[model samples]
Target chain A: MTMYNQTTDERVDKALANSFLRQATRRATDRLRNNKYKASAELGNWEEWRAAGEAIRKNVISNLDYYLNQLIEQMEKRGVHVHLAKTPADAVTVVRNIVSEHNAKNVLKSKSMISEEIHLNHALEEDGIDVVETDLGEYIIQIAGEPPSHIIVPAMHKTRQQVADLFEPIAGHALSSDTPTLTRFVRTQMREKFLRGDIGITGCNFAVASTGSIVMVTNEGNGRMVSTLPRVQITLMGMERIVPSFRELDILLNLLARSATGQRFSSYTTILTPPKNTADPDGPEEYHLVILDHNRSEILGDKLFRSSLNCIRCGACFNVCPVYRQLGGHAYGSVYSGPIGSVITPLLEKDWKKWGHLPYFSSLCGACSEACPVRIPLHDLLVKLRMRKTQSGHTPQVERQIFKAYRYFFTREKTLRRALRLGAHLQRPFVRNQRITGGPPPLSNWTNSRTLPMVAPKPFMQLWADLKNKR
Target chain B: MSNTSDFISNLAAKLGRPTPTQPPPQVKLSVPQYQLSSSAERVSVFLQNWQALGGKGAIVRSEDETLQCLKQWFGEQPITWFKENSKALLAWDKLPTIAESAFSSLNWPLTRYSQSAFDPRDRYSIAASAELGITGSDWGISLSGTVVVKSDPLRGRAISLLPPRHLSFIESTKIQDNLFNVLEEVAALGSPPAAIEMISGPSRTSDIEMDLSIGVHGPIEVYVIVIDH
Candidate 1:
């Protein structure tokens, strides 16, 4: 389906060339990282909280079917309509049918990565339904007709002037290129949409399985507005977004808010259970919860990538990923982007070879793993994906044989010493400025994005060999 | 819609197992660590944390004090207020005049929300025109310093969200130490409202150049009145 607009390297090149995006990413991530440091420090036992968060996520994912069903039963008991979608097509059809049934023309959505993955907006648009994004960031990107670059901050790449430029046409007048003016413009513009919207679609942050409540944490009040003002509220949740109780939520949310925006708490954290009771004056009368699998079952059973589902979509990993910081989210070429994206995108797609190259995009810095709130070992997952790719015969014959020969010699110290001696002479022609920028066929590929260090005149093994002999 | 079994069976087949008919055992986790000595201490912490979150708060001992605090914090700003009409506590002479409210949507006592759900098409302009929203909180959390608001006919969600300012009144007795405490309390009183919101501060955004902008879609200024009496 040509998911990635460009190859990874080409996309990285484009991101690197845009000095503006570089500065913006640097500033935003640094600000968030600093805020995270301060907020976490205030917790006094941040590591303990992190470990606790990881444990809860692990427990829930292990018995996902049980918890998901429990959540469904609880919601049903409360008169909530729960739908299970095994595929993207099933999910889209369910939502489309509901829209058609309600005769809903206008649909307002808050920030939802799953919605982006399923291409919900396009599906609704094809049905000729008028859809509007209510989140300030999503609203801007929707109008621009671009997918969100970052999960938390969709319009992170757009400048104030750029944002104003996008809004100026809608406002039909010149607008100031400042934060307040741009935000005020969006506030006024989206208010009418919220009041006129027939259906509100929101992403579930954490669904309390025991209580039957779907939770959403947002900085702007859009989440509250979208869920409250509309009559029919449709919540699109990834099946794995379930937690056992609010107790787990306390620890996870602390890390999520602190790590995402450095806030002690988000401005609004809403827990909506079901259809409004008779006494409840104003809320969505029709509540629909769609639990989407979308091939997540494949990852659930797989031991290597199961932990990837623990992600709360806080975008904390994206902020810390050195690769993501350099290349940006668009470079990942998936609905989900950054470290979590690399791990899940390949598993979700049927064509491993096409989407499989994503795992190799990482430099294995492990910053994302370290920054992860639930402690998903992203770098380790990447390495495992590479091994799987090679084991599946995706690696070319020449490259496989070369690696086999290298492994053979590397296992024996005698062969390694002899090979180092031979390689020192062979590399003489290629060594430039004491770095191997160019060499024979196989080694040249390694130098494409990096410079290989020149072989020392005397190998470290040899220098240490004399000392060992004396001892 | 597919039944739970079919989805579970499909997943089990992929996982190489059968769906368990028995419910999984519930695992007990540690309760959150927020130990406050008394209600007064909690409300004190709530006020501090609320201010730290960029919202304004005042702890008062009487109705007159609430009026004084309201005037001192949000003076002359038009606001729509929500309360139990069955037992009204605060007097109206001090209340600001709001141009419109959620109650203005075809009169109160919706009888059955499902039968006559809020139709956005009919009342698109009422919520957007307010400067502030005033409502009494169901409960308050001290550790997070948040006021929990339950959405009902009296207080629609838009009152706190649409306006640029929010004036929330919290009873000193309704304060809890942590989020779990509040949830446990809500559980004690069975049958949760359709929607419950734990609002910590005024609505804010950091989308543009990583700059903090308050009152983007909801109120920018939030003033909490802690009724100690």
Candidate 2:
């Protein structure tokens, strides 16, 4: 399956139970969380930094149209080609045209969610062009032929042994499960692709409107290698990913690294201005920036949800999300998954039938909102999306009927009290030793993995009324 | 290719929002000011603290001492020395005569540089990658023992990133009382040229199966040269 699309909840449940995935995800996330804590503590004024980051993002998104125009003007002035794609299809077509024009047979890609959003890899491969993912996590998923399971740690679901098994036949070496050995093998294998690839594609972490430059932050120098080694460099950025100036980038970078992985800084933050002058020998001769609106421009002007565009893709929401912790990213069935995904996917894809159920996946705990670096009120947005979905008639008929019956019973107090008393008595067979271990057909899904709490013998309100009468 | 206006119109239609006639509003929030502690002991405390944060540092009295330290730290190993073509570096005593074969300048564009310089197989023991990776520190944050490297052509974002070992030279006077102080300094500099990166230690990640891997994506080794002169 492509990286953007995901399997259903049942498939995700099976994946999450896999002892290997649970161990790896838990370990990696724990360490990342700890390091982030320490790093932020060290910074001393992390809250101020976060506030500054949020303010800067809020400013840019508010004036996105103007900055985008300014960015286009600057890029064009520098002789860098800029393309604006309104849809994922439009984005794919633009990239395909560039690849076809360059006769690109092998395309080396840096990790870009925009490319994933457009399914550019599948598009390129369909045209018989070999698209190789060079990021270590992306590389692992590409080989397994699965979409990324997490935003920051794409291959968070895979074990090292699994990676070793996948690479052994390809490398013709007895690669070990040891981190160093496996990483070393991938490095050797990817180096050849970097040197010979026809095009280098990357995602823009932030685009500087003032200079027409795209900023990419990475720990691996692959971003640098990919953007620099190839004859052509193409960057795909969401339209809302613009910042007015570099000074603003400083604040964002502090928050981005700290919130995403809890590092003082990513090892490398590369900013490529239009190709260097003729006197310079080391950059792509052809530079292209694809500004994708896919659905971001709409999110920008939205009153309740425009703040969603302020996301830096730090994956902080996913890391802290309780539902994501249980179901993993695959269940969300979108390139952007977890709290951010629930809000964004529906907005991006107008087809609510496919994505409408996603917003309900959250428990409305507000943990995602707290974890968000740019301070996007992700939980509120998820609830709003759910409301929108219902208003748009995307709710299933069965669910609507169930809620309708509940609404009728709950509006009248006498009916509600009688129903509760009857529910306690009727649930006796299903309830054993104070908890419902097994239930009727409709409630079976709840009891399948979770036990339902035993209903009290008497309603609390009724008990309170009896006590008052005795007094 | 579709015209730019068509793309913008299509985007507006998809988002179901009114087409913005002008740009969105720019909100200018007052950035908080950061003041450095004016204590004589703060500098030494900062240095000691920085060392505790996995950073290596030393005080050199003269050029001779600098060369001696270099020899002691890395001797006879094939090394890539990145020194500026500046007069100060040129005037160093007992400077090693790096043959044309030994050194490569950062003159190559980023792509060519990666191919020629990076060898995962250990073909080269060291790469004196650039003449120098000059960075004007956005003030060193004493509280965290971190230094911010704002991106510029002279700093060459890659200098701090690509090498297996990174050496950054900063003046002694630039170290500040805390991270907030640095933010104020950055704000005062107005808009930085392009990018500003706060580097604490060597490139590190615990990503692969929770194993702490140094240099997974950036330099494995990091050195900070604090020049008192």
Candidate 3:
């Protein structure tokens, strides 16, 4: 399957050319980062909390099977229907079957990255089910017929004027380019969907293994609307999204809220044990939890990449990533983006040669790793991915040839010194003021943006030899 | 439905181990704790935090003060709006007798929410139509200014959710220092209720250009009357 619509450079070029997207991403990320900094600092021991969060996630992932089993048992015990989906297609089919069995027409969805991963909306829409995205950002993107650009703020790339344009046609008239005006319009639109939606599809933030409950941390309260209003509630959960109990949840929730949106807590943290009690007034009557593997087990097996599963989907790393700051999520051309996305996309796709170039999306700066609340060593993982790509012989032929020549030359000091001596003379034509201003194909690619310092007049080894003689 | 056993077993194989029958011992990790020395500190911190989250309310020493607070809130609204509108208040049926009497005395159209009062669908629409929702919070976390509400057979979740404005009473004694303490209290119960929500503030979103918009899908305004008595 062609997951990325554009080539990597093409995508980056397109994102870079869009000045509005650049400004929007920078503004949104800066605000989010500032908020996160304040929120984490308010706790007085942010590192301790992050460490505790990392430990909890590490423990849960290490014993994922046990927790999955316990969660399934508890959910079933609570009269919730549990389905295991091994692939994206399997998950789509499960949701489709549930929709058909209930003969449901309208499906209201909250913001869920997994749902995007599984391509739930397109599949359901093809089946002629009216699926509505309830989260304001999701709703905006849904109407715009676009994929989410950011995890938390899906419409981060959209300006208020752009949003006004998107809502104008829906409202059957022009609307103002003000946040409140736009928000009120969508609120009216979504309330009808919430009340009339037959099935509520939500993404599980954390599935409590001990209690058989799904936790939703949302600011818009759409999560609550989806879970509580619809008759049939279906939660799409990645197999790794599990906490041992509510106790672990306390730590993770604190970390997630502070990291994701820089709030002491999200507006609503709903811990719902589904299939409301027999006498309960208004929660969903039928509850279904889809436990999806979708190559997560493959990731879990590779010790190097296993920690990526510990991500709470907080998107904190994205804010701190310099590459992401330059090129918004869309530039990555994956449902997941930023440093974490660079590390995992190839692993999840299992075609390093095809998706392997994603690791280059990073600058090797460890800001992502430092910003990560769960302490996923994202920068290290990206480097390892690059290494894996080379080991698997996925490097470009020209690049490989250069490396091969270097390996041969370095092995013979005489040949290396001879080649370097010749190169310094050959570069004279392109050299200007001790910098290479222009060169041929491979060299020009680097020189086009920034001049490269002429290969030092004397190689480092030669300089060392002269210094040794002077000593 | 696909069998979970095969799925889990396959995962176990990837981990280079069999699916163990027993769960590993859980490590005991200490959660970060916050403490306020006195109830006064708790109430002040909670009110301060709540206001910071765009919530408006005050601490009242007596039930009469709580009534006066609610009455003054209505007084701020133009009387004509209530007259032309439903003038309805959606409330949890089991509110403290004082709040219940206060609601009756307001002489406004009131919807007391209970499972048996209306069908499932009707409860949502009714709550959605009401101008305000009033309920009692089980606990309040002081640091975050969060109100913990439980949904059971007797109470509908929509009481605090569907309405645009929500006012809930939280007893000062029930205020906890932080979310950790409130969570510990919930876990101490045999099991979680059908649904429990830790609502920190009014529904808000910053999706469009990172502009803050309140009450996108839930209550736009939330108030908590912390009764110190």
TM-score for each model: 0.90, 0.83, 0.97
Model 2 CA lDDT for position A247: 58
Off by over 4 Å in 2: A2-7, A413-424, A434-437, A451-471, B6-61, B78-203
State the local distance difference test value for candidate 3: 0.87
lDDT of 1 by residue, B1-229 (tens): 5788888776677557665577555545563476889877998999999998888888776545655665566443323232322111111111212211222321321121122225543333444544445567889989888999876655566666765667777778999988777887776656667888999887889888888898788878888878776
Clashing pairs in 3: none
lDDT of 3 by residue, B1-229 (tens): 4697887787788888887788777757775678999988998999899999999978887657766887787784634546755535777768876677666666554567674245778778878887888889999989898999999776789888998899998888999898878878888896889899989989999998998889899999898888777
Look at candidate 2 and tell me the lDDT of residue A285.
70
What DockQ does every candidate get? Answer: 0.46, 0.22, 0.77
* Candidate 1 local distance difference test against the native: 0.78
Which is better, 2 or 3, measured by TM-score?
Answer: 3
The true-versus-predicted C-alpha distance at residue A263 of model 3, in Å, is: 0.3
**For candidate 2, lDDT tens digit of each residue in A1-471?**
752454466666675777777666666666666767777766677777777778888787666666787788888887889998878998899899999999999899989999888888888889999999988888888888777888898988877788899889998878779988877676667766766778899999988787677888777767876775566888899988888776577677778888888765665666667555433323577889898887676676567888888899988888777777776677677778888988898888877978887898799999888877677889999889888888898887877888999999879999989988998998899887789877776678679888898878988879999999999
User: i-RMS, every candidate?
Assistant: 2.8, 5.2, 1.3
Candidate 3 chain A — worst ten consecutive residues by lDDT sum?
A: A1-10
How large is the C-alpha RMSD of every model relative to the true structure? Answer: 4.9, 5.9, 1.8
Q: After superposition, how far is residue A75 of candidate 2 from its true place, in Å?
A: 1.5
Number of the predicted model whose TM-score against the real structure is largest: 3
Model 2: which docking level applies?
incorrect
List of clashing residue pairs for candidate 1: A281-B152, A281-B153, B164-B219, B164-B220
